[model samples]
Target: MPEHHSGRARRIPPTLAAGLISLLAVLALLVTLPGTATAGGVKRPVHPDRDWMGVTIRAHEDGAGPSAAAQLTASVEGVDVSSHNGSVSWSSLWNSGVRFAYAKATEGTSYTNPYFTQQYNGSYDRGMIRGAYHFALPDNSSGTSQANYFADHGGGWSRDGRTLPGVLDMEYNPYGDTCYDMSASELVRWIGDFVDQYRYRTGRDAVIYTSTTWWKKCTGNNGGFGSVNPLWIPRYSSSAGELPYGWDFHTIWQYTDSGPTVGDHNRFNGSLSRLQALANG
Candidate 1:
């Protein structure tokens, strides 16, 4: 694996790195609490049994403890993780107010997250609405090939009303070639190819994940993909800023990379029921 592949959560400019460090300590504590309980009757795990990166991700969500004040701002709060999170305690996350999760599945058609099975299965076993995502590397491979690989590995969708459509994470290129060295039209074409393959395989559109700057530069504010894929916008600051060309509203907003108790906090822009509808697709 290339040393630059640090997963989707850390894909950000160096200038903003210092500002985000303060939140890392707090965010890593999401599943590191010695003892605590959430407001909705979910408690911490008593005997943790999950493992990642040599860490034990135990759960204690007994649904019987003094509830702590919920700090999640959105109607639906969740986390997206890769190997960086290391042995996640899925049940504890649900007990701690995480309603959904998007785990890193495959990247550039060849790289599949080693923890994909554990994270995906753990979230589902714990009753959290779970989905898988693929990291786009347009510079390295065809989008269709990557999409097919993603589905075959872990990004496949179901009508179980709990699996969210797969996400196409095409943002700041982690491996040097930002925009994947593609022209505006070529970038749009690559994304279209990805969306088509994902839709054909899953019978649902893939959510498009990208930052405003990347979208502007690569797609030239292209709205061609608006009808097929909903936008999953990422902004680290307090505000979401301007969105891409097509959508008047975003389906999902990645509000922050570091949460008070987790990494990469995300919000579904609708009520819980509405979120379930999207999941049910």
Candidate 2:
């Protein structure tokens, strides 16, 4: 599933969809400002030992840009193109710098991502490790059903000869009539149930992707899932100095929406080797 507008359920004129798609296509490339190593300086080599937990990230900048070839380290460095539409070139983008990627697999019970197989197979064929994610339903009745749909439809991670972990995208469903209506416990149960079933079928851990606000609001103090699975935390503004609370560790931190890619328009994500370690652990 490529990235799309959140409020897609509301009826939009066909013209609007085409216009939005074109807008996204252009915005994707312009949004990613070059990531500079230091302020007012040329791009420097990414220090493998530097702590990247809460770095202030941007995909592009106005003046000086980070040298494109500089290398940095954390653990696992990758991107999540689930939000990007299916038109992105996964192999070229991943080969640019991304070490691993997670593709959108299924959304609700009936809605499978149109690009799942293409991106999944594309990444695998290029020898870029990849994973799949199911956009979990916030509703109680459909949560389990959506999870099962992913398990059944999402191809085997092992079958592809890749080790990247599958993910359960637990963010708010933008299509809902009411905003932020689901309770914290309810979301946890929904997410937990999905992970349980996914593991049962795939024998692999399901990583959780959510924003700081969603986690704090929906899960509250309940960190039950944090103990068992690696979390992919999405914090848009915080700098590297501010440590995220509640979770013991995160597998990936989506630090910015602006990232450079050969043929992408919106944003990209970053992580460290810890992600791969989490997948193996």
Candidate 3:
């Protein structure tokens, strides 16, 4: 009655408005944090650090390999690193007896490691046989496209003794479904596409990096790749235990994630000369 009636929004108290803004900010941050829930209620990390080689396997599988002490005694020791390792010290790794390395080069079809040159070349400069690996994301793009992306980046190989064939790191999906929503047959086809394209591009058969559990679950233990692609099997146990269906032996066995100086440690399942033979090929 006192004032002419006109609808107007009321202003909130300063303290309440500030609190509301702070809460909203926190919610936004949580959405992007690693392992936080995203679309479809899947905990996917928005950042690439969580896409490293063994991250999914470590998150999903459980096994204790031989003691790190026992595995460290192998003569042909190596390490695998990604951006998750930042700028690694290759000299320290070489001094610590790391003779070979694999660095993350690309992922999916869009993402390339920011530190690829540093890690890939640094290892070679330090006299370590080095290669690049591509982390597969089948659902996002076709395997041939992803392989082209990888080869165009640092994934190309040479017959020099210091360069190893590029690696295809196929494992559990870190972003969403374990198999990237692809059935076993679909995954096998995708892998076939990738390896075929990679071979066509690089002139060397790409090495296959996968865990036995993942190999069996995602590819139905596909035996077709064993004859052509070298297998790099991850097993944190005393033995690589029965390998996937086709392979009778593992080419490179990643024995422990908690390596001494820097990255995950692996043992070449052969002598140093044999390791050179692989690189030479």
Candidate 4:
């Protein structure tokens, strides 16, 4: 048996055997690496759990701009809530000057916020012009599928003058590669897929929620959606420093994750009536 195997093994070329050994060594090295795996030109691990908006930004780019209290300018106040926030107090937020709110509804095609009904409905019940947002997980499924799941869950919009358009939370990936293992153009296409399908489903252009750093890094600062989608920028600083390339202005600026009230605090770029007009539209 040993002689038979030796005869067969000798049939391989010396160069091919060397190449096979080298490839196995490379594979072994990758497998031994602690926290990263190669996918589509990026190195990261896949975490299928739901990650809320701004998770990556808070991890990587927090404190890059002015303090959260720097901008004393007058604007409509708001908050964005996720499952992390649990059941939010709508009346307390409203009384504390939160005129608008966004509750996380869905993530990917698999997860929906358990507290969505209470947060989304409670804000509206308290007379806040509220919207629902989907925390996008582009790596798990096609953008169209995620959009459908989001709209079907709680991310629907109505022109009742009290309901705002749904938001697409497009920040950095909480569980995987920063750009979901996609190239910049590919990420742009995914976003287009989501917004286009969302508009088809709800007849409203979805608001895009992202930070400038993640936008520039992942999308290569693509400006295609800026013409139609309102930008929701997260800064966590006093001033919303530089915006991504496509947007001239931010519709909503999420300035702080730790608000005095609850969840992330935001400021609309316009007056209360303008906010209403946005809701009506």
Candidate 5:
């Protein structure tokens, strides 16, 4: 969710370069985080209340980062999060009209979300359907290892509609190499291994979250994943972008990484019954 338009920053410190920008970011972080203790004696993580997470995404007429959401039709709106969102009050988010969520659970085989337990359970408590995601690092570890790590940690599945299937986030590499330097055929093989292991472990196909460009360049425009997995595409400008190489349609479209809530905004492309069917399996 944090990756949008190349200005995305996972947190505040890493992206601050200009002196004035750093000063303003400090001021912004200070202003957003406040005394957040519950009356029930529960302490919460301070939300880094960011307007645009340091990037300039001027989508709406107001010139803010997705300052306004498109008036969606025949769809169920949702949101997603990672450590980038820090601590969030999910109940408040649910009241804002999000029906489901996807939380970044693990990256590769080594990294795990420090805030996943709180966010996952919090979403369920607030009556929002939730799913866990794994940020793929095919170069870092074997696909089986990373998939197992994700599934073992918080990526498990259930029949309850409150829980969605696991998602695999394969995008432009955040580090240095975008494709992890894997050849197109190699990339395809690696992804195949991930899906195979994910289905073997969870008994459900993993959702592939990617952009059309990345799919074409990294996997040589391979459409093989379409058979075993549903597609989730991230396109900020409009909802009518070309579907990736893998599928005829996307089940979920993340229209914007900026929303009225703590994470990137998304929507189910079909009716609630179809969404429920996806969740049931």
Candidate 6:
């Protein structure tokens, strides 16, 4: 079973990863579904998982901006290795129009995503822009120890030419019976400690990943670490709309689980010049 820790919950253990792979096998057996018309009149499949979220091509019609499909670069919205294939095989994703990726790094002291190095290095070698994430540790005896463990693992970005930033996964550990023991302020402080130490060593601003529920319960509108770091908000739904709160402008918008990809296993994702700006910063 996958171990659950406060700052260590986001990553999928080897056993869990193996289970997901097997789950996909079962999912493949489901009957194929057809596409439906979206609000924009764009026809999209009801269940995109069946087709690997194939890329959509649109022309510059009705006086819209230049056609994105013609440009050959598409926006990518994706999760870490828990959802997509291992990092090294992401070349198919790049070719299929995936614009960005986030790979799992470390969680607390005991667990590190086994695929982190393979995926991070592999994505870089294939010229795919990618980021790294550290699961937020809860405020307890293991908090700082987990932060040190992440620092030791190098978190994701190297001091090389890579541009994307590291991410701090801040969702609460649902499995812990006492997970709600910490007050909101305490949670903010714990997250801040992780970000501060990570930035000190990596020389890059670590981004924050959280949903509205987790942000409200833990951060309590404190905006942990302030506006100095970027935010990667995850809001999945049919609409691909704006974030709930008037939060800082997100660097990456994880808009959908349904996306285009290069191979049968990879996922599509999106981002703007935000990544370039971070790289130059």
lDDT of all the models against the reference?
A: 0.72, 0.55, 0.85, 0.83, 0.74, 0.53
Q: Tell me the TM-score of model 5.
A: 0.75
Worst 10-residue lDDT window, candidate 2:
48-57
Error of model 5, residue 158, in angstroms: 1.5
> Residue 72 CA error for candidate 1 (Å)?
7.2
lDDT of 1 by residue, 16-64 (tens): 7766885786777654552233444323323221211102101211112
Candidate that would win on lDDT: 3
What value does the lDDT take at residue 56 in candidate 2? Answer: 17
- Candidate 4 per-residue lDDT, tens place, 169-268, comes to 9977776678888899989989999999999999999999988888889998888988899999988776888988888999998888776787878889
lDDT, candidate 3, 1-281, per-residue tens:
58775698778999999999999999998886645665655343356665877877777778665545474465598999999899999989988888999999988766789998999999999899999999887876788998999999999988888899999999888777899888999999999999999989999999899998888888888899888899998877676667887887889888788867888888888889999999898
TM-scores across all candidates? Answer: 0.73, 0.64, 0.84, 0.81, 0.75, 0.62
lDDT of 5 by residue, 112-137 (tens): 78888888888888888889988776
The most accurate candidate by TM-score is: 3
Q: Write the per-residue lDDT of candidate 2 for residues 176-221, one digit (tens) a residue.
A: 3222356767666776777787777778777777655545656775
* Clashing residue pairs for model 1: 43-61, 44-60, 44-61, 45-59, 45-60, 45-61, 46-60, 48-58
Candidate 6 lowest-lDDT run of ten: 52-61
TM-score of 1: 0.73
Model 5 lowest lDDT segment of ten = 48-57
As a whole number from 0 to 100, the lDDT of residue 208 in candidate 6 is 73
**Candidates 3 and 5: which is better by TM-score?**
3
Q: Which residue segments of model 2 deviate by more than 4 Å?
A: 1-75, 159-161, 177-180, 238-246, 262-281
TM-score (C-alpha, index-matched) for candidate 6: 0.62
> What lDDT tens digits, residue by residue, belong to model 6 across residues 97-179?
55556666665454566666777677767776666666654632345565567667746455454546777766645324223
